[model samples]
Target chain A: MAQKQINGTTIDVNDEGYMTNHSQWNKVIAATIAEEEGITLTPAHWRVLDFIDHDFQEKGVVPGMRRMNKVGGIPTKDLYELFPNGPIKKAAKISGYPKPASCV
Target chain B: MTGSQPISKVSIVVSRGSLEGIYPGLIMANGARMEGIEANLFFTFFGLYGVLKNYNDKIRVATVGNPAMRVPSAKGLPMPTLLGAIPGMSAIATWMMNKEMEKIDIPPIPEFLEMIHDAGAGIYACKATVDMFHLTKDDFIPQMDKVLTVGEFYEQSAGGQIIFT
Candidate 1:
Protein backbone atom coordinates (compact mmCIF):
# COMPACT_ATOMS: atom_id res chain seq x y z
CA MET A 1 0.00 0.00 0.00
CA ALA A 2 1.05 3.55 -0.66
CA GLN A 3 -0.23 7.13 -0.48
CA LYS A 4 -0.87 9.23 -3.56
CA GLN A 5 -1.78 12.90 -3.78
CA ILE A 6 -4.08 13.30 -6.75
CA ASN A 7 -5.65 16.64 -7.61
CA GLY A 8 -4.44 17.96 -4.25
CA THR A 9 -6.27 15.23 -2.32
CA THR A 10 -4.44 12.46 -0.50
CA ILE A 11 -5.54 8.96 -1.50
CA ASP A 12 -4.36 5.46 -0.68
CA VAL A 13 -3.45 3.08 -3.46
CA ASN A 14 -2.37 -0.54 -3.57
CA ASP A 15 0.74 -2.00 -5.17
CA GLU A 16 -0.99 -2.29 -8.54
CA GLY A 17 -2.16 1.38 -8.33
CA TYR A 18 -5.77 0.62 -7.46
CA MET A 19 -7.38 2.75 -4.78
CA THR A 20 -7.46 0.91 -1.46
CA ASN A 21 -10.08 3.12 0.19
CA HIS A 22 -13.34 3.68 -1.63
CA SER A 23 -14.20 6.80 0.41
CA GLN A 24 -11.33 8.78 -1.12
CA TRP A 25 -12.45 8.13 -4.68
CA ASN A 26 -13.83 11.08 -6.61
CA LYS A 27 -14.10 12.21 -10.23
CA VAL A 28 -10.84 14.11 -10.08
CA ILE A 29 -8.93 11.16 -8.68
CA ALA A 30 -10.50 8.80 -11.17
CA ALA A 31 -9.54 11.00 -14.11
CA THR A 32 -6.03 11.41 -12.77
CA ILE A 33 -5.50 7.70 -12.39
CA ALA A 34 -6.95 7.08 -15.83
CA GLU A 35 -4.60 9.67 -17.29
CA GLU A 36 -1.66 7.67 -15.99
CA GLU A 37 -3.05 4.71 -17.91
CA GLY A 38 -3.22 6.85 -21.08
CA ILE A 39 -7.00 7.06 -21.17
CA THR A 40 -9.13 10.18 -21.71
CA LEU A 41 -12.43 9.82 -19.90
CA THR A 42 -15.30 10.28 -22.31
CA PRO A 43 -19.03 10.12 -21.66
CA ALA A 44 -18.96 6.48 -22.71
CA HIS A 45 -16.22 5.90 -20.13
CA TRP A 46 -18.21 7.62 -17.39
CA ARG A 47 -21.25 5.57 -18.31
CA VAL A 48 -19.32 2.40 -17.52
CA LEU A 49 -18.01 3.80 -14.24
CA ASP A 50 -21.50 4.81 -13.21
CA PHE A 51 -22.84 1.40 -14.09
CA ILE A 52 -20.02 -0.22 -12.18
CA ASP A 53 -20.78 1.80 -9.06
CA HIS A 54 -24.50 1.20 -9.39
CA ASP A 55 -23.89 -2.52 -9.74
CA PHE A 56 -21.43 -2.57 -6.85
CA GLN A 57 -23.99 -0.89 -4.59
CA GLU A 58 -26.50 -3.60 -5.41
CA LYS A 59 -24.26 -6.66 -5.80
CA GLY A 60 -21.72 -5.83 -3.09
CA VAL A 61 -18.87 -7.06 -5.29
CA VAL A 62 -16.96 -5.51 -8.12
CA PRO A 63 -18.72 -6.68 -11.28
CA GLY A 64 -16.47 -8.81 -13.50
CA MET A 65 -16.50 -8.64 -17.29
CA ARG A 66 -19.18 -11.33 -17.47
CA ARG A 67 -21.39 -9.47 -15.01
CA MET A 68 -20.87 -6.23 -16.89
CA ASN A 69 -21.93 -7.99 -20.07
CA LYS A 70 -24.84 -9.97 -18.62
CA VAL A 71 -26.21 -7.71 -15.90
CA GLY A 72 -24.75 -4.23 -16.47
CA GLY A 73 -25.78 -4.45 -20.16
CA ILE A 74 -22.38 -3.43 -21.50
CA PRO A 75 -21.02 -5.80 -24.10
CA THR A 76 -17.44 -7.00 -23.62
CA LYS A 77 -16.46 -5.60 -27.04
CA ASP A 78 -17.65 -2.11 -26.16
CA LEU A 79 -16.10 -2.28 -22.71
CA TYR A 80 -12.80 -3.17 -24.39
CA GLU A 81 -13.13 -0.15 -26.67
CA LEU A 82 -14.13 2.22 -23.85
CA PHE A 83 -11.27 1.25 -21.54
CA PRO A 84 -8.91 -0.28 -24.15
CA ASN A 85 -6.03 -2.61 -23.25
CA GLY A 86 -7.44 -4.55 -20.27
CA PRO A 87 -10.88 -3.02 -19.80
CA ILE A 88 -11.62 -4.91 -16.59
CA LYS A 89 -8.34 -3.92 -14.95
CA LYS A 90 -8.35 -0.37 -16.30
CA ALA A 91 -11.95 0.26 -15.27
CA ALA A 92 -11.35 -0.98 -11.75
CA LYS A 93 -8.27 1.22 -11.43
CA ILE A 94 -10.09 4.34 -12.55
CA SER A 95 -13.26 3.48 -10.63
CA GLY A 96 -11.34 3.02 -7.37
CA TYR A 97 -12.02 -0.60 -6.63
CA PRO A 98 -10.06 -3.83 -6.45
CA LYS A 99 -9.85 -5.54 -9.81
CA PRO A 100 -12.60 -8.06 -10.39
CA ALA A 101 -11.64 -11.73 -10.13
CA SER A 102 -13.26 -13.95 -12.76
CA CYS A 103 -12.49 -16.46 -15.50
CA VAL A 104 -15.69 -16.13 -17.55
CA MET B 1 0.52 -1.44 -14.37
CA THR B 2 3.89 -3.17 -14.38
CA GLY B 3 7.16 -1.98 -15.94
CA SER B 4 6.99 -4.51 -18.73
CA GLN B 5 4.57 -7.19 -19.95
CA PRO B 6 5.72 -10.80 -19.60
CA ILE B 7 2.93 -12.69 -21.40
CA SER B 8 1.40 -10.63 -24.16
CA LYS B 9 -0.38 -13.59 -25.75
CA VAL B 10 -1.08 -17.33 -25.47
CA SER B 11 -1.78 -20.19 -27.88
CA ILE B 12 -3.88 -22.95 -26.31
CA VAL B 13 -4.27 -26.40 -27.86
CA VAL B 14 -7.26 -28.53 -26.89
CA SER B 15 -7.11 -32.18 -27.99
CA ARG B 16 -9.57 -33.89 -25.65
CA GLY B 17 -13.28 -34.15 -26.33
CA SER B 18 -14.45 -34.68 -22.79
CA LEU B 19 -16.06 -31.88 -20.76
CA GLU B 20 -13.09 -31.84 -18.38
CA GLY B 21 -10.59 -31.67 -21.23
CA ILE B 22 -12.19 -28.81 -23.15
CA TYR B 23 -12.93 -26.41 -20.30
CA PRO B 24 -9.35 -25.83 -19.13
CA GLY B 25 -8.41 -24.39 -22.51
CA LEU B 26 -11.57 -22.28 -22.66
CA ILE B 27 -11.03 -20.95 -19.15
CA MET B 28 -7.40 -20.12 -19.87
CA ALA B 29 -8.26 -18.40 -23.15
CA ASN B 30 -11.00 -16.43 -21.41
CA GLY B 31 -8.69 -15.56 -18.52
CA ALA B 32 -6.05 -14.38 -21.00
CA ARG B 33 -8.40 -11.93 -22.69
CA MET B 34 -9.67 -10.71 -19.33
CA GLU B 35 -6.08 -9.72 -18.53
CA GLY B 36 -5.81 -7.90 -21.91
CA ILE B 37 -3.54 -10.56 -23.38
CA GLU B 38 -4.12 -11.83 -26.89
CA ALA B 39 -5.46 -15.42 -26.91
CA ASN B 40 -6.25 -18.08 -29.50
CA LEU B 41 -7.73 -21.55 -29.00
CA PHE B 42 -6.77 -24.35 -31.40
CA PHE B 43 -9.18 -27.26 -31.38
CA THR B 44 -7.54 -30.40 -32.78
CA PHE B 45 -8.21 -34.16 -32.84
CA PHE B 46 -11.31 -35.00 -30.80
CA GLY B 47 -11.19 -31.49 -29.43
CA LEU B 48 -13.05 -30.43 -32.58
CA TYR B 49 -16.21 -31.72 -30.90
CA GLY B 50 -16.09 -28.70 -28.61
CA VAL B 51 -16.87 -26.28 -31.41
CA LEU B 52 -19.32 -28.42 -33.36
CA LYS B 53 -22.81 -27.02 -33.30
CA ASN B 54 -24.36 -30.50 -33.00
CA TYR B 55 -21.83 -31.86 -30.55
CA ASN B 56 -20.63 -29.15 -28.14
CA ASP B 57 -23.46 -29.40 -25.65
CA LYS B 58 -23.70 -33.16 -26.01
CA ILE B 59 -20.17 -33.74 -24.72
CA ARG B 60 -20.00 -35.36 -21.28
CA VAL B 61 -17.50 -35.97 -18.49
CA ALA B 62 -15.08 -38.88 -19.01
CA THR B 63 -15.87 -41.26 -16.20
CA VAL B 64 -14.99 -44.68 -17.60
CA GLY B 65 -11.30 -45.50 -17.23
CA ASN B 66 -10.86 -42.27 -15.24
CA PRO B 67 -8.97 -43.03 -12.05
CA ALA B 68 -10.23 -39.87 -10.40
CA MET B 69 -13.84 -41.02 -10.38
CA ARG B 70 -14.43 -41.36 -6.65
CA VAL B 71 -17.13 -40.54 -4.10
CA PRO B 72 -16.59 -37.19 -2.31
CA SER B 73 -18.79 -37.52 0.80
CA ALA B 74 -17.87 -41.16 1.20
CA LYS B 75 -14.15 -40.25 1.10
CA GLY B 76 -11.51 -42.27 -0.81
CA LEU B 77 -14.06 -44.80 -1.96
CA PRO B 78 -13.54 -45.58 -5.62
CA MET B 79 -16.78 -45.13 -7.48
CA PRO B 80 -16.60 -48.70 -8.78
CA THR B 81 -15.25 -48.71 -12.31
CA LEU B 82 -18.10 -50.89 -13.40
CA LEU B 83 -20.55 -48.35 -11.98
CA GLY B 84 -18.93 -45.54 -13.97
CA ALA B 85 -19.05 -47.80 -17.00
CA ILE B 86 -22.84 -47.84 -16.63
CA PRO B 87 -24.72 -46.04 -19.40
CA GLY B 88 -25.78 -42.85 -17.59
CA MET B 89 -22.96 -42.30 -15.10
CA SER B 90 -20.97 -39.94 -17.31
CA ALA B 91 -24.07 -37.83 -17.92
CA ILE B 92 -24.78 -37.74 -14.19
CA ALA B 93 -21.26 -36.58 -13.47
CA THR B 94 -21.40 -33.95 -16.19
CA TRP B 95 -24.67 -32.63 -14.80
CA MET B 96 -23.21 -32.40 -11.30
CA MET B 97 -20.14 -30.58 -12.66
CA ASN B 98 -22.28 -28.08 -14.56
CA LYS B 99 -24.35 -27.33 -11.46
CA GLU B 100 -21.25 -26.71 -9.37
CA MET B 101 -19.72 -24.49 -12.06
CA GLU B 102 -22.91 -22.42 -12.28
CA LYS B 103 -22.72 -21.64 -8.58
CA ILE B 104 -19.30 -20.05 -9.20
CA ASP B 105 -20.53 -18.07 -12.27
CA ILE B 106 -19.06 -20.28 -15.01
CA PRO B 107 -21.24 -20.27 -18.10
CA PRO B 108 -22.25 -23.29 -20.15
CA ILE B 109 -20.26 -24.51 -23.17
CA PRO B 110 -21.96 -22.44 -25.88
CA GLU B 111 -22.36 -19.35 -23.70
CA PHE B 112 -18.77 -19.56 -22.51
CA LEU B 113 -17.58 -19.54 -26.13
CA GLU B 114 -19.62 -16.41 -26.75
CA MET B 115 -18.10 -14.71 -23.73
CA ILE B 116 -14.57 -15.69 -24.76
CA HIS B 117 -15.03 -14.59 -28.36
CA ASP B 118 -16.84 -11.40 -27.39
CA ALA B 119 -13.84 -10.57 -25.23
CA GLY B 120 -11.67 -10.58 -28.41
CA ALA B 121 -10.12 -14.05 -28.22
CA GLY B 122 -9.76 -16.02 -31.41
CA ILE B 123 -11.36 -19.49 -31.58
CA TYR B 124 -10.18 -21.80 -34.34
CA ALA B 125 -10.50 -25.39 -35.55
CA CYS B 126 -7.58 -27.43 -36.79
CA LYS B 127 -7.72 -28.20 -40.50
CA ALA B 128 -6.12 -31.67 -40.45
CA THR B 129 -8.52 -32.82 -37.78
CA VAL B 130 -11.41 -31.36 -39.75
CA ASP B 131 -10.39 -33.41 -42.79
CA MET B 132 -9.89 -36.60 -40.76
CA PHE B 133 -13.33 -36.20 -39.20
CA HIS B 134 -14.86 -35.23 -42.59
CA LEU B 135 -16.19 -32.06 -40.99
CA THR B 136 -16.81 -28.72 -42.67
CA LYS B 137 -17.00 -25.14 -41.48
CA ASP B 138 -20.78 -25.39 -41.36
CA ASP B 139 -20.45 -27.93 -38.55
CA PHE B 140 -18.75 -25.37 -36.30
CA ILE B 141 -20.39 -22.65 -34.24
CA PRO B 142 -20.44 -19.06 -35.47
CA GLN B 143 -17.91 -17.98 -32.87
CA MET B 144 -15.11 -19.94 -34.56
CA ASP B 145 -12.94 -17.56 -36.55
CA LYS B 146 -11.52 -20.03 -39.10
CA VAL B 147 -10.04 -23.46 -39.69
CA LEU B 148 -6.25 -23.24 -39.85
CA THR B 149 -3.65 -25.73 -41.03
CA VAL B 150 -0.84 -26.69 -38.67
CA GLY B 151 1.55 -24.29 -40.41
CA GLU B 152 -1.00 -21.52 -40.50
CA PHE B 153 -1.81 -22.06 -36.82
CA TYR B 154 1.87 -21.84 -35.97
CA GLU B 155 2.25 -18.64 -38.00
CA GLN B 156 -0.79 -17.11 -36.33
CA SER B 157 0.55 -17.98 -32.89
CA ALA B 158 3.99 -16.52 -33.51
CA GLY B 159 5.43 -14.96 -30.33
CA GLY B 160 2.76 -16.37 -28.02
CA GLN B 161 3.15 -18.91 -25.23
CA ILE B 162 1.86 -22.31 -26.33
CA ILE B 163 -0.01 -24.57 -23.91
CA PHE B 164 -1.63 -27.98 -24.41
CA THR B 165 -4.51 -29.49 -22.44
Candidate 2:
Protein backbone atom coordinates (compact mmCIF):
# COMPACT_ATOMS: atom_id res chain seq x y z
CA MET A 1 0.00 0.00 0.00
CA ALA A 2 1.01 3.58 -0.66
CA GLN A 3 -0.30 7.01 0.26
CA LYS A 4 -0.93 10.03 -1.89
CA GLN A 5 -1.59 13.56 -0.70
CA ILE A 6 -3.99 15.42 -2.92
CA ASN A 7 -5.17 18.95 -2.10
CA GLY A 8 -3.50 18.41 1.32
CA THR A 9 -5.71 15.42 2.04
CA THR A 10 -4.05 12.04 2.48
CA ILE A 11 -5.52 8.92 0.90
CA ASP A 12 -4.44 5.29 0.77
CA VAL A 13 -3.54 3.89 -2.61
CA ASN A 14 -2.36 0.56 -3.92
CA ASP A 15 1.15 0.06 -5.14
CA GLU A 16 -0.03 0.95 -8.63
CA GLY A 17 -1.39 4.30 -7.34
CA TYR A 18 -5.06 3.36 -7.48
CA MET A 19 -6.84 4.81 -4.48
CA THR A 20 -7.88 2.00 -2.16
CA ASN A 21 -10.47 3.96 -0.18
CA HIS A 22 -13.49 5.00 -2.20
CA SER A 23 -14.79 7.33 0.53
CA GLN A 24 -11.76 9.52 0.13
CA TRP A 25 -12.62 10.22 -3.51
CA ASN A 26 -13.93 13.64 -4.43
CA LYS A 27 -13.94 15.81 -7.51
CA VAL A 28 -10.80 17.54 -6.27
CA ILE A 29 -9.04 14.27 -5.67
CA ALA A 30 -10.17 12.94 -9.03
CA ALA A 31 -8.85 16.02 -10.76
CA THR A 32 -5.50 15.67 -9.04
CA ILE A 33 -5.35 12.02 -9.99
CA ALA A 34 -6.21 12.73 -13.59
CA GLU A 35 -3.53 15.40 -13.68
CA GLU A 36 -1.07 12.81 -12.54
CA GLU A 37 -2.11 10.68 -15.53
CA GLY A 38 -1.46 13.71 -17.79
CA ILE A 39 -5.12 14.33 -18.34
CA THR A 40 -7.13 17.49 -17.59
CA LEU A 41 -10.56 16.85 -16.22
CA THR A 42 -13.33 17.29 -18.76
CA PRO A 43 -17.09 16.75 -18.66
CA ALA A 44 -16.75 13.60 -20.73
CA HIS A 45 -14.14 12.25 -18.36
CA TRP A 46 -16.35 13.12 -15.40
CA ARG A 47 -19.26 11.38 -17.04
CA VAL A 48 -17.35 8.09 -17.12
CA LEU A 49 -15.91 8.60 -13.66
CA ASP A 50 -19.29 9.42 -12.15
CA PHE A 51 -20.81 6.42 -13.83
CA ILE A 52 -18.07 4.17 -12.50
CA ASP A 53 -18.45 5.54 -8.96
CA HIS A 54 -22.19 5.14 -8.96
CA ASP A 55 -22.04 1.73 -10.54
CA PHE A 56 -19.42 0.52 -8.09
CA GLN A 57 -21.48 1.69 -5.14
CA GLU A 58 -24.42 -0.26 -6.43
CA LYS A 59 -22.76 -3.34 -7.92
CA GLY A 60 -19.58 -3.60 -5.81
CA VAL A 61 -17.65 -4.11 -9.05
CA VAL A 62 -16.47 -1.68 -11.64
CA PRO A 63 -18.31 -2.05 -14.91
CA GLY A 64 -16.40 -3.68 -17.71
CA MET A 65 -15.62 -1.68 -20.84
CA ARG A 66 -18.47 -3.34 -22.67
CA ARG A 67 -20.89 -2.37 -19.93
CA MET A 68 -19.37 1.08 -19.74
CA ASN A 69 -20.13 1.64 -23.41
CA LYS A 70 -23.61 0.12 -23.32
CA VAL A 71 -24.76 1.38 -19.93
CA GLY A 72 -22.68 4.50 -19.39
CA GLY A 73 -23.44 5.59 -22.99
CA ILE A 74 -19.87 6.59 -23.60
CA PRO A 75 -18.67 5.20 -26.90
CA THR A 76 -15.62 2.93 -26.89
CA LYS A 77 -13.59 5.26 -29.05
CA ASP A 78 -14.38 8.14 -26.77
CA LEU A 79 -13.16 6.17 -23.74
CA TYR A 80 -9.81 5.46 -25.36
CA GLU A 81 -9.54 9.06 -26.48
CA LEU A 82 -10.22 10.26 -22.95
CA PHE A 83 -8.15 7.78 -20.97
CA PRO A 84 -5.42 7.33 -23.63
CA ASN A 85 -3.32 4.60 -22.06
CA GLY A 86 -5.93 2.40 -20.38
CA PRO A 87 -9.57 3.42 -20.03
CA ILE A 88 -11.26 1.00 -17.59
CA LYS A 89 -8.44 0.72 -15.05
CA LYS A 90 -7.57 4.38 -15.31
CA ALA A 91 -11.19 5.36 -14.86
CA ALA A 92 -11.48 3.03 -11.88
CA LYS A 93 -8.36 4.50 -10.32
CA ILE A 94 -9.56 8.04 -10.90
CA SER A 95 -12.89 7.20 -9.35
CA GLY A 96 -11.07 5.82 -6.30
CA TYR A 97 -12.15 2.27 -7.01
CA PRO A 98 -10.00 -0.79 -6.63
CA LYS A 99 -8.42 -2.31 -9.73
CA PRO A 100 -10.77 -4.65 -11.49
CA ALA A 101 -10.15 -8.29 -10.66
CA SER A 102 -10.04 -9.26 -14.32
CA CYS A 103 -7.50 -6.68 -15.38
CA VAL A 104 -3.80 -7.64 -15.42
CA MET B 1 3.98 9.10 -14.20
CA THR B 2 3.71 7.60 -10.73
CA GLY B 3 7.23 6.15 -10.94
CA SER B 4 5.88 3.18 -12.89
CA GLN B 5 6.46 2.58 -16.56
CA PRO B 6 3.25 2.87 -18.51
CA ILE B 7 2.21 0.78 -21.48
CA SER B 8 1.19 3.65 -23.73
CA LYS B 9 -0.22 1.51 -26.52
CA VAL B 10 -0.28 -1.91 -28.15
CA SER B 11 -0.94 -3.16 -31.67
CA ILE B 12 -1.99 -6.76 -32.31
CA VAL B 13 -1.65 -8.38 -35.72
CA VAL B 14 -4.08 -11.18 -36.44
CA SER B 15 -2.96 -13.28 -39.39
CA ARG B 16 -4.83 -16.53 -38.97
CA GLY B 17 -8.43 -17.32 -39.83
CA SER B 18 -9.15 -20.19 -37.46
CA LEU B 19 -11.29 -19.62 -34.42
CA GLU B 20 -8.46 -20.52 -32.05
CA GLY B 21 -6.01 -18.19 -33.77
CA ILE B 22 -8.41 -15.28 -34.02
CA TYR B 23 -9.59 -15.34 -30.41
CA PRO B 24 -6.12 -14.79 -29.01
CA GLY B 25 -5.79 -11.47 -30.84
CA LEU B 26 -9.26 -10.36 -29.89
CA ILE B 27 -8.81 -11.32 -26.24
CA MET B 28 -5.42 -9.62 -26.04
CA ALA B 29 -6.63 -6.43 -27.67
CA ASN B 30 -9.59 -6.29 -25.33
CA GLY B 31 -7.30 -7.00 -22.39
CA ALA B 32 -5.07 -4.09 -23.35
CA ARG B 33 -8.07 -1.75 -23.47
CA MET B 34 -9.23 -3.01 -20.10
CA GLU B 35 -5.84 -2.16 -18.64
CA GLY B 36 -6.07 1.42 -19.95
CA ILE B 37 -3.68 0.87 -22.84
CA GLU B 38 -4.47 2.04 -26.33
CA ALA B 39 -5.08 -1.07 -28.47
CA ASN B 40 -5.22 -1.61 -32.22
CA LEU B 41 -5.92 -4.87 -34.05
CA PHE B 42 -4.76 -5.24 -37.64
CA PHE B 43 -6.29 -8.11 -39.57
CA THR B 44 -4.27 -9.39 -42.50
CA PHE B 45 -4.27 -12.44 -44.77
CA PHE B 46 -6.77 -15.02 -43.64
CA GLY B 47 -7.30 -13.11 -40.41
CA LEU B 48 -9.76 -10.98 -42.33
CA TYR B 49 -12.33 -13.61 -41.46
CA GLY B 50 -12.54 -12.00 -38.04
CA VAL B 51 -13.75 -8.72 -39.54
CA LEU B 52 -15.67 -9.93 -42.57
CA LYS B 53 -19.36 -9.41 -42.02
CA ASN B 54 -20.41 -12.77 -43.42
CA TYR B 55 -17.57 -14.92 -42.09
CA ASN B 56 -16.82 -13.38 -38.73
CA ASP B 57 -19.52 -15.33 -36.99
CA LYS B 58 -18.85 -18.45 -38.99
CA ILE B 59 -15.19 -18.97 -38.24
CA ARG B 60 -14.36 -22.55 -37.30
CA VAL B 61 -11.53 -24.17 -35.43
CA ALA B 62 -8.93 -25.48 -37.85
CA THR B 63 -8.58 -29.11 -37.06
CA VAL B 64 -6.77 -30.31 -40.11
CA GLY B 65 -3.01 -30.25 -39.70
CA ASN B 66 -3.46 -28.73 -36.23
CA PRO B 67 -1.54 -30.99 -33.90
CA ALA B 68 -2.54 -29.05 -30.80
CA MET B 69 -6.29 -29.65 -30.92
CA ARG B 70 -7.32 -31.41 -27.71
CA VAL B 71 -10.54 -33.00 -26.62
CA PRO B 72 -11.39 -30.85 -23.61
CA SER B 73 -12.84 -33.59 -21.39
CA ALA B 74 -10.29 -36.12 -22.50
CA LYS B 75 -7.71 -34.47 -20.28
CA GLY B 76 -4.55 -33.89 -22.32
CA LEU B 77 -5.31 -36.46 -24.98
CA PRO B 78 -4.45 -34.82 -28.30
CA MET B 79 -6.85 -35.27 -31.13
CA PRO B 80 -4.96 -36.86 -34.01
CA THR B 81 -4.60 -34.43 -36.87
CA LEU B 82 -5.51 -37.22 -39.28
CA LEU B 83 -8.87 -37.68 -37.61
CA GLY B 84 -9.41 -33.94 -37.95
CA ALA B 85 -9.39 -34.24 -41.73
CA ILE B 86 -12.61 -36.22 -41.71
CA PRO B 87 -15.71 -34.45 -42.93
CA GLY B 88 -17.52 -32.38 -40.27
CA MET B 89 -14.64 -32.63 -37.80
CA SER B 90 -13.82 -28.98 -38.03
CA ALA B 91 -17.44 -28.07 -37.36
CA ILE B 92 -17.52 -30.37 -34.36
CA ALA B 93 -14.38 -28.84 -32.96
CA THR B 94 -15.76 -25.38 -33.51
CA TRP B 95 -19.01 -26.26 -31.81
CA MET B 96 -17.25 -27.74 -28.80
CA MET B 97 -15.01 -24.71 -28.42
CA ASN B 98 -17.94 -22.33 -28.67
CA LYS B 99 -19.86 -24.34 -26.10
CA GLU B 100 -16.97 -24.31 -23.68
CA MET B 101 -16.52 -20.58 -24.13
CA GLU B 102 -20.22 -19.98 -23.49
CA LYS B 103 -19.90 -21.81 -20.20
CA ILE B 104 -17.51 -19.08 -19.10
CA ASP B 105 -19.65 -16.20 -20.45
CA ILE B 106 -17.60 -15.42 -23.52
CA PRO B 107 -19.88 -14.17 -26.22
CA PRO B 108 -20.06 -15.11 -29.87
CA ILE B 109 -17.82 -13.49 -32.44
CA PRO B 110 -20.20 -10.73 -33.46
CA GLU B 111 -21.00 -9.80 -29.88
CA PHE B 112 -17.35 -10.12 -28.97
CA LEU B 113 -16.44 -7.60 -31.65
CA GLU B 114 -19.09 -5.25 -30.40
CA MET B 115 -17.73 -5.60 -26.88
CA ILE B 116 -14.12 -5.01 -27.87
CA HIS B 117 -15.07 -2.05 -30.05
CA ASP B 118 -17.05 -0.62 -27.20
CA ALA B 119 -13.99 -1.05 -25.04
CA GLY B 120 -12.10 1.35 -27.34
CA ALA B 121 -9.95 -1.06 -29.34
CA GLY B 122 -9.36 -0.10 -32.94
CA ILE B 123 -10.08 -2.80 -35.55
CA TYR B 124 -8.45 -2.51 -38.94
CA ALA B 125 -8.39 -4.73 -41.99
CA CYS B 126 -5.46 -5.18 -44.30
CA LYS B 127 -5.92 -3.18 -47.46
CA ALA B 128 -4.00 -5.69 -49.54
CA THR B 129 -6.07 -8.57 -48.24
CA VAL B 130 -9.29 -6.73 -48.93
CA ASP B 131 -8.15 -5.93 -52.44
CA MET B 132 -6.93 -9.45 -53.06
CA PHE B 133 -10.22 -10.89 -51.93
CA HIS B 134 -12.25 -8.21 -53.75
CA LEU B 135 -13.83 -7.21 -50.47
CA THR B 136 -15.51 -3.85 -50.26
CA LYS B 137 -15.75 -1.66 -47.21
CA ASP B 138 -19.30 -2.85 -46.73
CA ASP B 139 -18.03 -6.42 -46.46
CA PHE B 140 -16.70 -5.81 -42.95
CA ILE B 141 -18.54 -5.38 -39.69
CA PRO B 142 -19.71 -1.86 -38.89
CA GLN B 143 -17.21 -1.62 -36.05
CA MET B 144 -14.18 -1.87 -38.31
CA ASP B 145 -12.34 1.44 -38.36
CA LYS B 146 -10.54 1.16 -41.71
CA VAL B 147 -8.61 -0.94 -44.20
CA LEU B 148 -4.99 0.02 -43.69
CA THR B 149 -1.84 -0.85 -45.60
CA VAL B 150 0.97 -2.47 -43.69
CA GLY B 151 2.96 0.75 -43.82
CA GLU B 152 0.03 2.75 -42.52
CA PHE B 153 -0.47 0.31 -39.69
CA TYR B 154 3.19 0.61 -38.74
CA GLU B 155 2.91 4.38 -38.83
CA GLN B 156 -0.12 4.46 -36.61
CA SER B 157 1.44 1.94 -34.22
CA ALA B 158 4.67 3.92 -33.92
CA GLY B 159 6.23 3.68 -30.47
CA GLY B 160 3.69 1.05 -29.45
CA GLN B 161 4.35 -2.61 -28.71
CA ILE B 162 3.40 -4.95 -31.55
CA ILE B 163 2.14 -8.49 -31.03
CA PHE B 164 1.55 -11.05 -33.76
CA THR B 165 -1.20 -13.41 -32.71
User: Against the true structure, whose TM-score is highest?
Assistant: 1
Error of 1 at B68 (Å): 1.9
Residue range B1-165, candidate 2, lDDT tens digits:
366877879999999999988998988888877676788999999999999998899999998887766775546679888888899989988898899876555668888898788777789999999999999999999999999999999998998989998
Candidate 2: residue pairs that collide: A85-B36, A85-B37, A86-B36, A86-B37, A87-B36
lDDT of 1 by residue, A1-104 (tens): 79999867999988888888999999989899999999999998998999888887887777876678788888888998888778888998899988786656
Candidate 2 lDDT over A12-71, as tens digits, reads 998899888877889899898988988898998889998998888888888876667667
For candidate 2, give the docking quality class from DockQ: acceptable
- The 0-to-1 C-alpha lDDT of every candidate, in the order given, reads 0.88, 0.85
DockQ of 1: 0.65
Leading candidate by lDDT: 1
DockQ score of the complex predicted as candidate 2: 0.38
Task: Show model 2 residue runs off by greater than 4 Å.
Answer: A23-28, A38-47, A54-60, A71-74, B1-9, B33-39, B73-76, B82-89, B99-107, B114-122, B145-161
DockQ-derived CAPRI band for the predicted complex in model 1: medium
In candidate 1, clashing pairs total 0
Superposed Cα deviation of residue B72, candidate 1 (Å): 5.0
